[model samples]
Target: MARGRRLMARDGVRPSYDPAGPDQALRAALQDLRTGRWMAMRALLADTTQWWRWTQRTQILAAAAAGTDVVRAWLAEEPGNVHAAVMHARVLVERALRARRERHRRTHELWIEAWDAAQSATATAPRDPVPWVCLLALAQLDPEQRWEEHRAAAPEPMLPPGPWGLLAEAGRRDPDNREAHHRMLQFLYVRGGSGRLAEAAGYAQWAAGQAPPGAAAHLLPLYVRVERYRRDSGHDAALDLHWVGDEAAREARRGLHSWFENTQRAERSLSDLNHLAHALWGSLQFSDASRVFEAIGPYFTPPPWMYRTPDRERAVEIFVQARDRCRAAADG
Candidate 1:
């Protein structure tokens, strides 16, 4: 009878409690989480759980959400189960999300901790979408740094060519998933540094129609582009350089501007023009920059930018200087 019971215990799911070394902290974290005993989990990882350890550093945080303890004991018992690992990560992420909703002064701090835990889990398991999911969450909170990291470190190209691709596949698998939509939206309207604009444009079109109302804030610039591209037969640098497509190729095919008159009717976003102007200036496309300045000149009032806040403040000054330079060169 004792032998049979012991054998049965062997077959049952165990929690991660590996004591071999620090590298097995994520395993230990999963173990702690399964035990439903937070104290035990804390004991298992005591002294070993240090910040930037990245593995043990962020485990069993779901305790706040799950209202369980004994995360450490669970790990000591069951060390190698991938399903458990995923479950543990999900719990933490959900908890993090919840915390973000009812946040107070310490909200960003909790989010940071949760993000760290998620990233650590992702680093441990690269292929799983859960970590990517969590990292995507973190991107909202710290996108400038986080997206830069994802773009710099992603295993694939910043954006791939195939349909049902990274952002597309995420949208398809979870259509109602705000996360997938939000991430791809961010991918579409990237401001600066290492974004693949062509792929970003593809994501914009794929994301345009059914992406969700929450994407409205992001849609303004893309809408204006789809508009400008349609009306401006002469301004095709983006289309020509990347082979994005003709203006007729846009999903809605509605022009943003009227060729009969040079006025723009859409809601204006100054930050969009600021980024566009800088990008064009960098490429020596003064004509494109001039068009951008002319189109968005009506709304160039003060506002904040995600990356280039200061530079955006100086746009009128910069545009004035550029305009004078172009005028001088044209006559000379």
Candidate 2:
């Protein structure tokens, strides 16, 4: 069993966030769609839809994250394309989120536009969970009371009646949708007050238990942990790995053994691997941490690593050093 231990930084210089390079495939796909390769883009979306549903959803989200313009153009070219509609709604919701984060003056207007797009998508693809997921994400932007009033006033309540209703619809459409569950967890996190973080943790644990064996949903608790740490460590210069408790270590170990170690599909998500590596390193399982680092290779996600600092470059630097230290200890 791995005992809990702190992995300290070398050189005593903390790192900061710098924008990382774009994912080439996602970038290229967005470019292709934007630059008149409509047939190719359609084929690509079709191919993704034929893949594992989770992968399809993730890829759609990735494409949507690239930009709304390409997806909008696709929608205009093929007005009845369900994929285009869903992606367009997702992009609008993402833009709404960005506007909220940046404190843009027209944030509410963006949210309304997102809500409209999501509703249209839902109508176009009644069986698709992706549109419901977008609606749930959009609902999360406002307080429940505010959203309730908005929903009541809306011509058609863009989403299903309520947050739970939207979530249930998403689940009904696809029971194994991790993104849908994640959206609910975020909703709960946003709604809770002083005990919000703890509530989020409880929800995460429950969701993980409800998920199929070896599913990535087991990693949800780690996300909660990262969020909690980020909130508590506000403006702190360095993150003390010791902040991660024994229970979290045990849970991380269980998650690794049950969902990560034996599952071939776990390789699809570098973010999950990064979280696992961070947990294992903090728990003094250097050898296990080393293995995860080997899997991660050149890619890094800046969440739990940068929970202390918003700097992506600094996060990558610390991640590399920590991985190196773990590998050395494991090899010795």
Candidate 3:
């Protein structure tokens, strides 16, 4: 077992939170962005055709580019280029979000700039859903839903009013967009209250129920589950039952059958896979969990695992123990 652990470490079997995950092209693109080159980014975005992949790639690229002027340079070099224009919006939005996180004095000003850029991106790429998704992302900064469009009515009575108009616009361009729904859920989280969590859970169920098989929207409930756990005061004592409960098991199995089984190996979201793997492991579904662990390979998103324990090292220990147990079960 010690030998196996050493081999695993040497083979890079430990979990990582690399944004690029297994996407070598995206990793290279990020490297290029850091070096003040935009060509690689342009090529990467150009090749991303699927709406879900486009949202994921743009988000990762935007975060990487927000710290630099590469995206602005891209816009300057290719004035009127729709892709560059959209990417410029992405970078602006990311910067605005970072500013908000840091409580920068210019948060409001930056938010307006992001909103304008995102609104412009919609014109630049009328058929693309990403710009609308960007708008949805920014909606979190406005907890009151001050903008009339931001306070649009929910589709169902139980759900609260939110930035549903922005969500609808994204859906219009690309129905059941995964990131868009997740962004909405984040907005619900920002409006923190006991009731808001209930709203988020309801919204997750609604989104998951409406999505087609294999849609990333199926992962929504698992995210809400984690959010609930994170907010629970007595989580330590209730942790085991919280995960292995009937509802948790149902959510895990539903996501496995609907999302994992239906998604192609290359197209799966690393974060989604991590959440599914965590959910299944927590629910004591080791046999099914092992398949997800194998699918995850060396990548890790720390949030799901980190929630298991307050001690960061202990969290990693839990992750390793679960992974090894799953692997051992599979070996039989």
Model 3 Cα lDDT, one tens digit per residue, 1-332: 88448436633665657999988999999999989999999998889898878888999999988999999988998998898988989989898889988999999999999999999999989999999999999988888777887778888998888899899999998888888999999899876322488888999999999999989899899999998887773536666777889999999999999999998988898889989999998898998999998888888778788877777666655777788787777788
Model 2 per-residue lDDT tens digits across residues 51-114: 2343344345534454536666777988888777777777788888778779899999999998
77-110: candidate 1 lDDT, tens digit per residue: 5656443454466455556555655665666776
Minimum summed lDDT over a 10-residue window in model 1 is located at 251-260
TM-score of each: 0.31, 0.79, 0.94
lDDT to native, each model = 0.42, 0.67, 0.87
Clashes of each: 24, 5, 0
What TM-score number comes out for model 1? 0.31
Candidates 1 and 3 compared by lDDT, better number: 3
Q: Can you rank all candidates by TM-score, best first?
A: 3, 2, 1
Clashing pairs in 2: 16-311, 17-311, 17-312, 18-312, 18-313
Model 3 residue runs over 4 Å out of place are 1-12, 192-195, 233-236
The TM-score of candidate 3 is 0.94
